[model samples]
Target: MEKDTYKTLAAPGEETLFKEKNSKFFGYAYPVNSEDEVKAVLEELRKQHNQARHWCYAWQLGTEHIQYRANDDGEPNNSAGMPIYGQIQSFDVTNVLVVVVRYFGGVKLGVGGLISAYRTSAQMALEASEIIEKTIDVHFTLQFGYQNMNKVMRVIKEKNLDIVSQKMEMDCEIVVATRKNNAPTVLEALQNLYEIEVKTS
Candidate 1:
């Protein structure tokens, strides 16, 4: 069965350096949710490692890990990017990006060597970083009158749902995030309140 939650890098950046056959490979891992963030991080890496020979990378997005990419940056096909991505899959984590920057050391490592180096470098980065588990959340918008605030709050407290945001004016509105697995139960309970309006976001 597919999991309701997943593991990903907890923080933004982690680095690992591997030297093989006199070639230097610097690996960097980052937590990201969108492609724009991926571009931003790659651009930043370019700025930081301006003199590197290749900027190979791989990224997986979303809990399902369906959206992903691998770029070899000029290295032989499957020698660099795919190996780096293999490490990501091996870790069984998503919503993360790993970039490996290669600095030519006057020693030419063949395809096999390149793959080993990239994979090891990527693994080193993940091993050094913190991994975090993230639950899949379903968002909801709740609208109700102030008179029902107590009732709604009581249910929220009982469920321990995360109140993403709330407004407490004449027309009270609250946005909440519930674990995807618990959404049905929570929605059923909320429906019992006739006056309160609930909509999934």
Candidate 2:
């Protein structure tokens, strides 16, 4: 069966802190839907942590066809970004951005240490977040005459479909939404009605 639900952060997670050999890693998790949002959040963090040595980050977007990016931001290649991204995958979340800002403490943490620290920081940030599951909805546009309005309303009421928009006139039109799993059933039900036009939007 195809999956129709996804997990995502409900809001910005609480800031987190991790330390290794006197080096500081400040972690943050934010809900993001696009690259623009990711860039905006990174810009804000850079301003907030102006003195930080490095700002490494990772973000995952989309639900089914997933897209993601990992940036070391001057940290050793694959040491910072991939580890942080690993935490995001372990948590099974999308549409989220995790960032780790570091302040050098005069001691160099080798690549292995850096990976562990970044992974821990990302995990901590996600742990502090409120994760929520949401259904993937499919929208359909419905067109019918006034005489068929009652039939359409009955199906909508019976199926508990959400009405995104509706226009009532000589020719009525409505935009309805239903969970992806139930879309076929809902579409069939509406199409069965006489003279009612149901098209996936």
Winning candidate number (lDDT): 2
- Alpha-carbon local distance difference test for all models: 0.91, 0.95
Give RMSD (Å) of candidate 1 vs. truth.
Answer: 1.4
Which parts of model 1 are misplaced by more than 4 Å?
none
Worst lDDT 10-window in candidate 2: 192-201
Please write out the lDDT profile of model 2 over residues 37-104, one tens digit for every residue. Answer: 99999999999999999999999999878999999999989999999999999999999999999999
lDDT score, candidate 1, position 2: 47
Per-residue CA lDDT of model 1 for 60-146, tens digit only, reads 998743799999999999998899899999999899999999999999899988999999999998898899998989888999999
Which residues of candidate 2, in runs, are more than 4 Å off? 167-172
Give the clashing residue pairs of candidate 2, or none. none
Residue 82 accuracy (lDDT) in model 2: 98
TM-score of 1: 0.95
The C-alpha RMSD in Å for every predicted model, in order, reads 1.4, 1.8
